[model samples]
Target: MNARLVVVAVGVGLSVAGCNVAGSRLPDPHLSGRDAQYMALVPTADVGAAYERYLVDFKTSEPPGSIVVDTKNKFLYFVEGGGKAIRYGVATGQEAYGWTGRATIGGMQEWPRWIPPKDMLERWPHLQPTADAGGLPGGPDNPLGSRALYLHEGGKDTLYRIHGTNEPDKIGQSVSSGCIRMRDIDAIDLYNRVKLGANVVVI
Candidate 1:
């Protein structure tokens, strides 16, 4: 089935509530190499929605360059204005514990190493690696895939991130530890699109 038809059949409100997308057409995924590998798996998922990256028409008043994350639906929308947007499937942390509200993109890293939070380590010390102080090095197998966007507020770190994941199939779920997880390729694409100080709303 065509991507647009597949989208409605899968029931994503035909284009998100209030999205007001002019049409149902969606562009192809922008990716290659490792990115393509992850994105390819997305279309094959059984989640019933076309969760792969889609350059869809979106209607919003959030301003261009702003990001709106619909955590409940596991979708992230990057408002491109003129009634356009890039939608990416995402996996969020536990509902009750996930980070929500306004934040800004404070920093980003490519192939960022994994840094186990203190509480996480305290709860699962056995997962700790003795290899390095900064945690696991960046790689295709690393959870932080190709990039990371650190979220912050008022110049302080929020400890929540929108980053790539090695687990591409998990993109449309609610099973993360408290971060926004994207396909490695999608993550890289988002990292490139977002700039420091850009506004982000998680609702």
Candidate 2:
């Protein structure tokens, strides 16, 4: 090969390699929002087999103006009308299980505080003493990873939240205390689309 041609080919190869690396580092499609505090890059190894069964495609058929949570399937469906829905993987209550009801999103916050209930402390004695001390500060380490949507019924707090989790592996599993947990990126995306007072149906 000619010397000039060799140099040009080497440059092209380097450029292609760079593009591949950049594309590999791109965030998952289910995550949205520009704030770094609301985003987390979880390792695929940690997530392992938990979400292996979940369908990655968010598009579906369920209709608009309604939310459906299928705990058995570890999926949350947002009806988008016209026989369509957006499915997201989720984590459900582990200890205090089997919650099925109708509720509305009362409010939402970014990186909200976590106040452990007395019951929770009692159930896990190791969490006693400081469990009722008003809670943990919001951050990446908090159980409520990035965003939180407080649920309510008849204008009263239901003590449940549709929130984010630091444990990406927990997605598509029953592993939370009582709240509904989602991947950080997916939760932020849902938070942006859902309005306060929107209906949520857990089944």
Models, CA RMSD each: 8.7, 17.5
After superposition, which runs of candidate 1 have C-alpha atoms over 4 Å from their true positions? 1-49, 130-132
**Model 2, CA-based lDDT:** 0.62
How does model 1 score by TM-score? 0.77
Point to the candidate with the largest lDDT: 1
- Model 2 clash pairs? 60-84, 60-85, 61-83, 61-84, 61-85, 62-84, 63-79, 63-80, 63-81, 64-81
How does model 2 score by TM-score?
0.72
lDDT per residue (tens digit) for residues 120-199 in model 1: 67667875772236688777767767789887777878788898887777877888767888877677777778888898
Off by over 4 Å in 2: 1-34, 37-63, 129-133
Which ten contiguous residues of candidate 2 have the minimum total lDDT? 1-10
Best by TM-score: 1
